[model samples]
Target: MSVRQTPLTCHGHTRPVVHLAFSGITDKGYYVMSACKDGKPMLRYGDTGDWIGTFEGHKGAVWGVALNYDGTRAATGAADFSAKIWDARSGHEEHAFQHNHIVKSVAFNPQGNLLVTGSNEKIIRIFDLQRPDAEPAKMMGHESNLRHCEFYTENIIVSCSDDKTIRLWDVTSAQEIRKLEFPNIVSDIEVSTQNRLLTLTHGNTVAFWNLDNLSLIKEFEVPTQIHSASLKPDKSIFVCGGEDFKLYKYDFDTGIELEAFKGHFGPVHCVRFSPDAELYASGSEDGTLRLWQTTVGKNYGLWKCVQAPSDLDKPGDAEG
Candidate 1:
């Protein structure tokens, strides 16, 4: 028997939701951010999807948004050819970094001191948050529009593009360290917290790679083209959504489909797991963000500390 668990819907954006990010868990709980074509990026409670506030300064459709480790700051890239940093607590703009073409992705280093922005110009730029007026460190190589990028280490980053490849680079040296080619255009990429495993979607396939040595670990073929996917921090489970308009969860080690459910009316564009590994959020073309618990009908956050009974408490006790 199963308990019918429903996702909490977050609404407000008038356009399609493109990207989503979750802040590391904190004393106040984790926060979620969403970027949409409506030109507004919003903050919400990670588990509940309750609206907190909106960061409202972008002049064009916002394509990507990320929250710093502690959720104190946020960075967003937009179709306006610029990226902006905001004080997450107050929803106030802090700095605006300009680009030559539409900005597609934005990410913050683990330390929260550096920001990386990828754009339609096929360039990746790293900006120092401490010195907003200074020139950003730039790197080049992607032949097509950028899709996503994330810091693999303090000095290294992995980025995917529509050119059907992924490249690893040294931010300090501004040189490519490794490149992995794919058969089709890569749509999205997600890395584990330890940066050891990465999962990506291209065409109708979802593949995993070893981030440490740059090797393909495994691949899973899905029925439809996936737009986004995320692996649980422990690498035990993964979830994906896309053209099928369904959310599919799988066991990473065995490649077994655990759950497949219909949710959004439109295709899902992005999905991310929370830091605590308890829940995940999905953004879709339906213009809303939905939150799902890792274990249906289970409240891990509240009952995680409760202890189970001893053997003596069982009906057939050993001592008896």
Candidate 2:
């Protein structure tokens, strides 16, 4: 037997992995970056699951991780009231950021020169990576815990929080430019490579927002609370997962649930799309990372791997 699905195991930490990201390809498609409650981040080759390097600097749990568009650098947010920039390949510290509260999320701007971070303190701060010691411009509008955010352009960034609102920030002014209120608290936000916005909130609803005007485009109701989402490099499609344990894909224009993947034994905590958008990776409270292939129709035999799927076939490996 071919064993059904391919699998790869990464087991260095004792705690659960909360977030994972693909560097868009600087490591020759071999490295996958991950963060955990243990207050550290690990980089390993996706093909062999060989631990390449480690990043250690946070006093509390590292809650979020993000890579620049170029894949040369990475950013991490921790409960220690700060977010830091690191050299993706060397694991060297680039900059340290101080925020109002425990940092919950961090994202690099679409241009890759600026960084945005959100926190329980209810504010988002914008930092210019070139100036490591300069004060960051603050964005204040969210009233509750701001969990995560994404940048739409060099000047605009959107953030969501428990306050039930999404606010847009202007990098130059480092202030709130606009706001959109949701029915419930937002747990995560993703901006598509094409500039469309998707946010997963307190309920099962995933609302698509238009960044140009900050208007609602569409929404699909899920069966459980959503935790995270990933936008394909194009604006046409995206995927999200939640405590409901269901993974969903939908059309950006119609809000139709096109297909789904269900097999994880625990709540899904995070989801991400690869640089090319052909593949995605997810981690959960259940202690596993699931990888899937997405297209217009159902995901067939392309791949479906947990903990690094070593079974079906490797990305560049030929079929047996």
Candidate 3:
């Protein structure tokens, strides 16, 4: 038997959703944040598609959104040429850091005291949340606009750019440690809890690398160009969505497409699994987000219900 899950659509944004991020699970619940061209970032329940609150302030489209470990704080990067921090509980703006160009990506360190942002200026800046007025540590090397970045460790960060490369940097010295060049322009990158780096490139392919050594691990070619992909915490499966307007699930080890389903009306821009491994959220060009379960409709518990066959087709009975 096959289980086909239905997705719950979340509506509110008036423009295309460019990014989606899930906060680390807590006793309360996990939160999902979305960045959109509408200039507003929204917070929601990670498991369900229910609305929580919207962080409104950016005058231009927000390209990036990230939540801290506890989901109490959030950071957003926008075309307004700035990155702003927010108190997620109150939905209030905390601090706004100015940039030389449009901010494209934003992330927070594990400690939650540092915020890293990559921008169209081809530079990555790390800001001390405790000192908003101080100058941020800058690392520059990308030949094109920066797209995505995340903390690989306490003292290191990984970044991907449109220049067809991913670079690793040391936080303290702001120096590039290593770089991995890809044949196609990298569009998005994600770091799993198991310390695996997954990247989606413009060539309709998905690649994985060892986060510690930045060495090539595996790559899979998809039928369509995937804008974003995320690996399951257990490394059993991965889900991706893109130009096909459908979500595709693949076996992580074999790279075989396990299942595919239509959930959005437009191209999906980003997809991320919940920290609890219960569900995943997808943001699309249709200006909405959808939530899907990790196991479709079947429960993975010890016991499962079985159905008995009817007598109608039990024997080779002749047709009337």
Among these predictions, the greatest lDDT belongs to 1
List where candidate 3 sits over 4 angstroms from the true fold. Answer: 196-200, 298-320
Which scores better on lDDT, 1 or 2? 1
lDDT pick, better of 2 and 3: 3
- Candidates sorted by lDDT, descending order? 1, 3, 2
lDDT of each: 0.87, 0.71, 0.85
* Model 3, residue 213: C-alpha shift (Å): 1.6
Q: Ten consecutive residues with minimal summed lDDT in candidate 1?
A: 311-320
lDDT against true structure, model 2: 0.71
Model 1 earns a TM-score of: 0.92
Clashing pairs in 3: none
Give the clash count for model 3.
Answer: 0
Q: For every model shown, what is its TM-score relative to the native structure? A: 0.92, 0.82, 0.91
Candidate 2: where are CA atoms >4 Å away?
1-9, 45-50, 234-237, 250-259, 295-320
For model 3, what is the error of residue 152's alpha carbon versus the real structure, in angstroms, after optimal superposition?
0.7
lDDT, residue 232, candidate 3: 86
- Give per-residue CA lDDT, model 1, range 93-171, as digits (tens): 9999999999999999889999999999999999999998999998899999998989978898999999999999998
